[model samples]
Target: MTEPLIELKGVSKSFGSHKVLDNVDLTIYRGEALGIIGPSGTGKSTILRIMAGLLAPDEGEIYVQGVRRDGLIEDGGDPVGIGMVFQQAALFDSLTVEENVGFLLYQNSKLPRSRIRELVKEKLEMVGLPGITNLYPAELSGGMRKRVSFARAIMSNPDNPSETPEVLLYDEPTAGLDPIASTVIEDLIRYLQSAQGVCGTYAVVTHQDSTIRRTSDRLVFLYEGKVQWQGTVSEIDSTEHPLIRQFISGNVHGPIQVAG
Candidate 1:
C-alpha cells in the first residue's frame, strides 16, 4: 500500500463556470481501499471519473503507475487496467445478466461464446450470484444489480491477463439500498480487496456511512471542490476537524452550508 498507483496533481475541472475540483491533489496507493466522501455536489464522483480517465481534467496532470496520461482513455491505454462501477449499475436494460457481465469479452475478444459464458459464470459466482445469468436487469433487486455490476467491472479475458483491472473506481455503489443491502455491498467491497478477490486497489465515492466506514481503510473528505481533510477510518471519530465532525454527526449548524 506504500507504492503510489494513481495520482492527481493540482487537478481542477469545471462544468461551464461552476468549478468542481479546484487544484485538488489526491493519490491512490496500491492495495488500498480509499473512500471519498462529501456532500452531494462536492465533485467526489468527478474525481473518480478523472481517475478512471473517463474525463480529462481541465487543469493539472494525472499519472497512472508513474506515467503521465496524455489524454482520455480513448487516446491510449494506461500502464495498468482501470475499471469502473457506475452508480446506476449502467447495465443495458435489454441485456440479460450474462450478456451484461460478459459484454466486454463479447465485443472485443475472439473468445468463443461458450468460453465467455463460462467466464461470466465464474465471475457471477465470485460475487455470490449464481444461476441468475439468464435473467434481465429488471428481474434483479437493487443489490443484485449492484453485484452484477461488480462482476462486470472485474471481468477480464483469460487470454489477455494484462487487461485485468488493477484498480477499480466505484461511484455510489450502495446509494439506493436498504441497510441490510448496503451492508452486503460493503462486505463485498472488502471481499474484493482480499487476496482471493480480483481487484485489491480501489477508490469508492460514497455517501453511506456504513459503506464508507466498512469499505475504506483511509478516507478523504471532499467539500467545496477540494480535499479538506484526510485520515484513517479510526481517526475519524477522534478528530475535531470541523468539516468531518459536521458531516459524521449530520449537524445542520456547522460550516457546511446545506442546500435548499
Candidate 2:
C-alpha cells in the first residue's frame, strides 16, 4: 500500500484544565481532499494548526511523508512545509494584490521582478479575480480578499525548488460569507484540486454542510475530542451514527450538546 502523506498517531492536546483532543489518529493521502467536521470548539482547527507546525501536541506524535514532526520548530521554521488559509483570510493590508500573491517568490526567489509580476497575475486569474492585482486588501470585499489569500498560500516556494509544500490546510474558508460568495469559494477549492500544474493534498476545517459535501470526497466527524467516525461523502448522508445523524440533520438534540 502507498504510505500516507501525513499521519497523526495517538495525538492529544490540552489547555490548562481543558482537554481539547484525546488520542486522535488520522491520515491524509496524496491528491485528496479531506474534510473535518464537528460541533463548535471540538478542536477541528486545532488539528490543522498542529499539523502545520504552528502548534504542538501535548502528547503523541505527528508524521509528514514518513518523517516525524518532533514538535514546534526549534528554530521557528516549518520543516514539513505547509500552506495555510486562516479563517479571517490573513493578508497584508499595506501591499497591493499583486504583491500579496507573489510575496513569497519576490522575497525568497532570485526571479526577476517582471517574472514575479506575471506569476502574480496568473494566480489572481486562477482565483477568478484577474484585473484587480493593483488593488489593496482594504479595497476588496471579504470574499475577494479571501480568494487573494488563497492565491498567496498556493504560490510556489522559490527558495527550495523541490519543496513545494505538498500540503494545504484551510480553517473555515467559507465562514461569514453569503451563500453566493461561499459557492464561489467552493468552486475555487474544486478548481485548485484539478488545476493544471498544481499538486498537493488538502485538509479543510468547516461546519458548512455544503462545503463538506462539495469539497471533500472523504470526511472525519469529530466529537468529544476524537475522530468519532469517518467515511466517504455518500456514506456521511447515509450513516446512522447518532452524532453524525444529529449533525447532518441539524437537530437541536442528539448525542451532541451545544455549548450554552
**Top-scoring candidate (TM-score):** 1
Q: Which stretches of candidate 2 lie over 4 Å from their true place?
A: 73-80
lDDT string for model 1 (134-236, tens) is: 9999999999999999999999988998889999999999999999999999998888888464879999999888988899999999999999999999998
C-alpha displacement of 5 in model 1, angstroms?
A: 0.7
Q: What's the true lDDT of residue 208 in model 2?
A: 95
What's the lDDT for candidate 1?
A: 0.94
Q: What is the lDDT of residue 30 in candidate 2?
A: 83
Each candidate: RMSD to true structure?
A: 0.9, 1.8
**Tens-digit lDDT track for model 2 on 54-138?**
8899998988878887767443444455788999988888999998888888778888898889888888888989999899999
Best by lDDT: 1
Model 2 lDDT, full chain set: 0.87
For model 2, state the Cα shift of residue 70 in Å. Answer: 2.1
